[model samples]
Target: MKKKLLTVAIGSAVALTIAGCNSSSNSTDTDTNKLLPKDATIAFAGVKAPVTDAEKRAILASDATITTGSDSMPLDLEYNVFARSGDTFDHAVFGQLVDKQGNPLSKEDGSPSIANSNEFTSLLPRGERLFSVSQFESRPGAMFLMELNQNTENGELSVKDAWQIDQSGVNGGWVHCAGSVTPWSTHLASEEYEPNARSLVTGADAAADRYAAGFLDYFNGDESQWNPYQVGWNIEVDVQADSGAAPTATSKKHYAMGRLAFELSYVMPDEKTVYMTDDGTNVGLYMFVADKAGDLSAGTLYAMKWNQTASTGVGAADLDWIDLGHATSAELSDYIEGANQLAFTDIFATADANEDNSCPDGFTSINAGGNGQECLQVKPGMEKAASRMETRRYAAMMGATTELRKEEGITFDPTRSKLYLAMSEVARGFESFKKNGADSSSYDLGGPNHIQLEGFNRCGAVYQLDVASDATIGSSYVAKNMSALVAGVPATDSYGDGVQNPIVANSADYADNNKCHIDGISNPDNVTYMSGWDILIIGEDTGSGHQNDVIWAYDFGTQALTRIQTTPYGSETTSPYWYPNINGWGYLTSVVQHPYGESDSDKDTGNGENRAYTGYVGPFPAKAE
Candidate 1:
């Protein structure tokens, strides 16, 4: 396949002619016909530095020249803000909380309660029509469906109808963070930062208390029916849309995947293997291999063990897996609905450790899921239930590494048989493991210290994992090796003296705004890999690493990082996904979430409107063979 350059101008509304681009070297002719050429490069020009204008810094803005290659083709890369937090479409208000019958819930002021933190979105095409499912990242989370109308001739998209998906059937979602579309065309969403069951039950956690308040509000103040086990599993939603009627969505929680604070779940090409990332401190990386292809109802769960080879530059490791047992979703669901309800005490017994951090004779001391060191003993005859329901604790009990910090988004590169995972920050247990080593009692308590690093990098890093066949797991896409593909560069002061920030006050200089190198990524949260193009799109969710979160495009061929977009101050760049071809039109979806909600909470404009945005970067022409 031959390649051509495509130039896109912002705010111009110009259109470009379709041209043949490079095809993937390993891709088949049929696959090549469906995607862009492998040699074709998507590059961004201009903007050598971060945004400095105060007005521009307060809004979502982009000033980059998007081009394909050397040849010139006129295309307009437009920014579309189609949906906001409180906007209404098709008689349904976005981000609005709803009841069991799908009616909108009201706030104390009698206004419709809305979710401000919107995260992942999946665009699914059905015949000539398109539908999108978006998740809200809040306590007692929510999800909605939108019918998108695309002008095939002009490559423009618009939402025609929208409504909230009913979640009462599987209990309400909690902190739906990020998601992906399955090969079978279902939306796979996540429930992040699962409330600590023991803490919630004992009223010992203030944060859990706050979460329970919001969750109780969702149930119309029904405190007796609250259940913490119902919200942490991966949820799969199947949408069926016909020609003229509203789409119907059916959802199920896959309890077989084990309970964790899931950031997202990425399924491998084989369909039986899945990689799931846990999102907080002292978290563990997990994998689930389904008993049958294309089904997640029953699977074997495994935790990662990082055997370190080098302790420099984000480190390197040979990966091993620890089988954590398995069960069907039905079995776990039965436990949730049964008379016992599987409370924290039913599966394990806990006790306070001595001042020296030593556990009793029968209890094991372990740290997992940012809960700090805990002394616990698994009850007899409840190991299977504990493995699936109290996953992090059980994994730690089985001697798996649980020192990962802020593990975020995941994407696969089938051509290279590789997987990319984002670690939002390289601190907390990650730094402690390096300083204390595996033998130290201060870190990794009861688990092994598989990862060791040289220094702390609060700016974070992106890791690449090699996938291969594992006979024991009976999957062809098991992750075998892990290493850092790219890491953020921590910045020093103007005098090159202090590693930490020297400028504490707000300054007019642009260089003082960020603690990490402005040219590299910081606190990368969501990542998407464009297969044929060899481009990785990285988004940031940072409060102090960078002043304004950015969306970056990294080209593997040239190893160049380009700043494609920047969100408002205190906002996050989320859901950077690429849909290669959707009815002869392509899109790169991007969402700017919670403007001025993070770092600049007190610096509101006072216009009475602060809503999150959901939109995309382009409608690139989809070429056929």
Candidate 2:
């Protein structure tokens, strides 16, 4: 194959240049006769090695190398920090809580409270200036906007102003997680782990009570107006930033998309079709086709039905979408406003299973959202309300598969007509057709036995879905089939035995303390696809699956997985996004969230205060066409 030469500059003041090459052995290589677009490619010398140093592993570390594609003059990875958790700008702290009037919030002791779990950071370029929105993942979630100034000469970004976006309009955001940038140049954020209104009002869940208490603070201790149904939807933020005046943000919640634990919603090239991944055990995959292009106000919701094709590895399936009906965001908002006082029993009729775990003939037996088997029948005249408000349960009632475990992120590959989804783990409902192999119809009953993998891999896998036009859906970007693209290899096959052993540190048989293969991905969370380069950037959110979470660069043409960045011991690798070109520069945005917050919490000591980091990988040169 012929190689294309490009120039890459390194260092601050002194520009050291070298030749970068784009060499591909696959059939998908760029045509030599055709001119490469400005966003087509970037040249890198080599991948970084895995971080294993005890001290370095306890903090963010990057050794990735880039080059002018020359063998010599290789450049080390350069991470540009935009801001940290508590960094102050525009008279407001980055992760600090603020009220509707932009006043800092305080805890019960009258002490300033701050959030450290920054999950998604999106940089939206408007005209000559740049804008960014970062969401804090907490009980009463918060989102902040920052105005950034780019030094055109060197591609360095500096935060000029920052302030929290008010969420009072949507009953306050909850558990904001992974997000994406829409085709219409807006920020699409997600509210994960939607509070189960059923359990919150029907039963006594201490965890739910605690969450309600914390969330009530967002309303100034107003419990009478607490509505769980108002949250758990996709939020779109339209940032209006002009040359002279400060930037203003307007947010709207898209209830047209069914309520579930959304990891992220990825809009296809068509702009009208969207794929939403639900995170958590016994969750379901969903897609929404909007009535109008670039508008999410009204849509038809559909859930995926997985038809198992293979039982080996992470399993393969032919996908069929189950239509869960449609509604407008305004209509769904009306339902929540009117039914705020209603309990789970008011919307659905339920019956307890017999001692032998068999439900009565009338009610449907299904398990969803990790909720145990329940016999439920949607009440009359509540089908539309049930479908939008209780999406997972309604999907199960419609015979859609709800067996996905920790389904995390979704990114589209327009060139290949493919969509990649991250399943943080391949365990629980994914490992068996029948829960616990029970013969009784009511025992651990779910929507359908669609996925049945041979072994349990807690290390997780990334699945690829083939997309094509469907006349029935009236959209050209519907997913038709799915299979594992890249999967992590667990240290042991815990299938059937039901014994999950911890990672054996310093084991001579395995490499170091890693429970999964050192080279493969572990707990893949948020993924982004670089368009012209055909590279999928995957980030990890793992605990025992791997000692340290790392970011990977998977080249589709070469089928090579390269470790590009590694985070601290307990931090999660998040918000890996590709901005092909912003002004004259290209960037790969990355966010390291909650350092030492997971398994390594006890290891957090000294000045390493476990703050989250929002930054980008590089300021690569913009390729020319």
Maximum-TM-score candidate: 1
RMSD of candidates 1 onward, in order? 5.2, 6.2
Clash pairs detected, candidate 2: 19-68, 19-69, 20-68, 20-69, 21-69
List runs of model 1 lying over 4 Å from the truth: 1-38, 46-50, 58-70, 202-208, 354-356, 433-443, 493-508, 623-625
Which pairs of residues collide in model 1?
22-37, 22-38, 23-37, 23-38
Clashes of each: 4, 5
- What is the alpha-carbon lDDT for the whole of candidate 2? 0.75
Candidate 1 all-Cα RMSD: 5.2
TM-score of each: 0.89, 0.88
TM-score of 1: 0.89
Sequence-dependent TM-score of model 2: 0.88
Q: How far out, in Å, is residue 16 in model 1?
A: 9.5
